[model samples]
Target: MSVSINKITVLGSGVMGHGIAQVSAMAGYNVTLRDIEQSFLDKAMEKIRWSLNKLVEKQKLSQQDADKIFARITPVVDLKTALKGADLLIEAVPEDMNLKKKVYAEVDSFAEDKTLYASNTSTLPITDMAALTSRPERFIGLHFFNPPQLMPLVEVIPGAKSNAGMVDMAMDYCKKVGKQPVLCKKDVPGFIVNRVFIPLVHEAVYCMERDNASMTQIDSAVKFRMSFPMGIFELADYTGLDVIHKATVEMHMRDAKVIFPHPKIKQLFDEKNLGQKTGKGFYEYKGDKYERVNLTEQEAATYNPIKLLAVAANNAAWLITNGVCDRAELEKALKLGMGLKKELFATMQEFGPQNVVKTLQELAAKYGQFYQPDPYLVSYRA
Candidate 1:
């Protein structure tokens, strides 16, 4: 069956949904932004308006184009009303399985047979959620990054029972919406980005807890030394330590062998230090300004943070070499999803895989199992 997606139905009117709707509308597709209540729908539309106007101010878009995009989106409270003629339905609800299942059940009733159902879930398995829908074959994971309109990469995860054609259809729709799509062979906890990244961040936190480094030094080292936009600690604060902790815990529960659970994260969470969202994480935040109080110079230079980061890069490379996804796709996801610089890959390619393995092995002996190189790295040998 051929699916020509002209109209898109975006379920949930939160941050991701609103952003996805904006992108769909900008791409000239008729979009219906749906929520459970009229108030939520109204707020989402207002946010979309604000975002579009900001784009216009930045010269990325014109007022006329912004008006046209807004006109393309129709906010609705009723699920069936929004989904009436939708060729594709993208669900961007909260990351609760029961909530997602319920939403999928409701969508299953109203969505047309040809409509492709795509979940914007970050970590949840598409196969598990697709069981709630009548058309499991049409269900796939369209994992978009936060602020979807700006991010270019989307993970196109086809459930085990999904139709082969659905993958191609989803990829086509992704390209149509100006998104780069990558395929996941099977559902894995944290998909691609979060799996390796969460562990790396957690390990960084663990280093802090061990008194090996301070938050400021760690973040500064990463940003200046490694050329990352932010340090792991700073990123945790920016992304919310609670968020990373929750994701790590969930991923650990799903795959015990790979994910190492951090006790300090739970300790900090218990202490109510939930990062920048709460004004205090590894550092303190006063309104819009952030003050670095936890970082020390000795911790920053004495500890080899770059070596730890290499372990993460190796894990990502392992995922690619093991056929979980392609190397190009992994690189794209890191650059787009995790805000990693493109040159990070160039650095690795320049270092050569064998050299990277030797460096990682030395770090592993000093830092523990987290820094250990994957077997694939050892075997690659340039």
Candidate 2:
């Protein structure tokens, strides 16, 4: 069956929620932005107005178009009002499994059976929350990057119970709302993007904590030699160390055999130095300024990224073998979503899966640390 998503109900009025509401409204969808209190709704509207103004001033949007877009979004404190006639509902609430389940239960009561439900969760599996809904076939993971108005990528993760039609409709809806959707074939913790990409960030921190390298050297090497615009450590500071720590904990829970950068990241989070938000993380920020670390070009090139890339490749292989996603989709997501050079995952395949294992072995033997090899990679020699 085909679905026409003309009305979008966005649950939550936080940064991501409001941004999603704004984009959906701008796309000609009648969007209802809901929150528990009127204050949250007001703040979200304020942010939306500011964003629209900036776009208009920059000529990305005309004032007349901005006003029309702003008019399409209706802020409501009532859940029923938000859910009524909503062909699609997106939950951008806090990342908690049980809490989300409860919200889904509430949404299920109010939303029509035909309404497709999606959660913008970054870490939890779509399967976990899908069971709570009577319409399990309608549940999916629409993991949108932060500031959804700007970020074009959205991972369309279907649970075991989700139907093919649901996935297709969700993908269609994503394009309608101006997003590039990637399918996470199976409902696994962290889905595709976090499952494969975030591990590299963790590995970078682990290398730092394990005395394998200094933050300065790692940052410089990543920036200058790895062909990446920003180092993982520095990116963490900009994005949020607390967010990274929480995501690591969630991912680690799902795959306990894997090692993560918990100790150091958690320490920073607990210290209330949650990256740029608090003006300190891997580095301190003082009034939009921060110090720089320098490394020689030769020294930077000598610093190996393969140590980090190995973990990502091996984990990606595990994901592929487990049916979370395949190599091609993973490559596309990494390239389009993260703006990474195509060589990262391509090299992983070119280097052979066993070479990933070999890299793991070398790292473990030298540093006395290694994640248990995925069973899929163990049996196959190729």
Tens-digit lDDT string for candidate 1 (252-302) = 778775566678777778888988879988777888666544544454575
Task: Give the worst 10-residue stretch by lDDT in candidate 2.
Answer: 288-297
Report how far off residue 122 is in candidate 2 (Å). 0.5
Can you write out model 2's per-residue Cα lDDT over 1-382, one digit (the tens) per residue? 6888899999999998999999889889999999999999999999999999999999999999999999999999999888999888999999888788789879888888678888888888778788888888888889888878888889998988998988998898889889999898877767776776667777888777664787777877766655555777777787787777778888888876544555777889899898878988887777766544444566676576666667876677678788876667877777666666654555555656677678788776775544656666666543
RMSD each, Å? 3.0, 2.8
* Clash pairs, model 2 backbone: none
Work out the TM-score per prediction.
Answer: 0.89, 0.90
